[model samples]
Target: MRVVTGIGAVAATVAATACLTFAHPAVAQDVKPDRAIKYRQSVLRAMDYNMDILEAMVKGETPPNKEVAAQSALFVEQLSHMPWSGFGPGTDQGAPTKARPEIWKDPEKFKSLQNDLMAATAKLAASAKSGDVAQWKGDFSAVADACRNCHRSFRAR
Candidate 1:
């Protein structure tokens, strides 16, 4: 009986120690800029394709198609994560970041840009659904302009 009790106590102690080791507060400091850079580059790639899609539609060099518009929408949605992820603690301030600190400082302005991006992209997607070449071109240009405008102010040159 004493041997069985000793075995049970040992098992309990091992389990408790294991749980404590695993449960220690994980230090999840901010994610490094390199990790976010990949995401940003992907967003930019999507934007580049979207721009090509718009230009092609506008020139009537290619068919005005829903796929182009859908792609634009997808990229715009994807872009939401880049700015915040790439800007802060994990990023080396001296590194080549196109992001300006004003984005974090001026929350209202930053949020406005985000809102405009979403709205413009949505409009482009809607126009694409209808396969309207003219509307697609207009919305595409507008969205691109918005992107440029934000980059001008918020992104580091």
Candidate 2:
């Protein structure tokens, strides 16, 4: 009788798991859009500060002042938290995202661009700590390139 009861419990658990797995997609769809939008908004704000840091770095005096280096480091740290939003089911797709519908259509291209940005940002942050003006300049340019590359493909006017 104990063996039979154990088997019955195991079967019930499996059945419950199967039901939840099948129901998850519909439940996920019920997720509020505002939650996604809020995440994107936070990323945008972080990117804004990052861009400002890059601008300051570019315009700052040669040899790079501590203030400038510190700003760049801050930018890199902020960017580390970015690119949180991309084209995905139920994600924002219009004006603010210009994330071309083609992003959904050609996922590989979008993902590549996103990866490129992440790599460049990671290198930029590392270079910022090097205190080598030349390295910083090169990494800075790479970061800008990544920004332009993604914007051209994903952002609409």
Candidate 3:
């Protein structure tokens, strides 16, 4: 328990030091476009924050905790289903965003990436439970690659 907690704290500290990404809640039906943007950012940022913990472990910057890793992966798996709602019509131009117009234009491609990410995270969540660092690391890479692939096509620099 302490180990899991300690890794989380250390992950937080490391995240604070690095150029970490930004967080937001669900948008109501009557929510403004900017609100949707905020909501999207929040979910992605939350994913990034949790991924940071797993990233640190994967990079060996901190010791890996299977429990902590599993927890983060599970959160990511759940989060993978979010943010798409925030990408509804008119959300392309609201607030500061890294999302690209391609996301709206080539939505099928974007949706495919979302599906890929969700699958990768699901696999990650399952693999993390076995506490096999090697398998965990490989699964982590698949998840990270899914993220990078999506960002390359759907998100701006």
lDDT of each: 0.67, 0.66, 0.86
C-alpha lDDT of candidate 1 relative to the true structure: 0.67
The order by descending lDDT is 3, 1, 2
Which pairs of residues clash in candidate 2, taking residues 3 or more apart in a chain or in different chains? none
Estimate, for each residue in 66-90, the C-alpha lDDT of model 3 and write its tens digit.
Answer: 7899899899989988988899878
Which stretches of model 2 miss by more than 4 angstroms? 1-31, 61-63, 67-71, 74-81, 93-97
Query: How many Å off is the CA of 145 in candidate 3?
Result: 0.6
Maximum-TM-score candidate: 3
Relative to the true structure, candidate 2 reaches a TM of 0.67
Candidate 1 lDDT over 2-116, as tens digits, reads 5546879899899989878766322223445666555555667766676776677678888666776666655664564344444445444544566677876876887788778
> What stretches of model 1 exceed 4 Å from their correct place?
1-29, 70-85, 88-95
Compared with the true structure, model 3 gives a TM-score of: 0.79
Q: What is the lDDT of residue 93 in candidate 3?
A: 82
User: What are the models' TM-scores?
Assistant: 0.64, 0.67, 0.79
What local lDDT score does residue 123 receive in model 3, on the 0 to 100 scale?
Answer: 91
Candidate 2 C-alpha lDDT tens digits along 109-141: 878877887787777777777666678778878
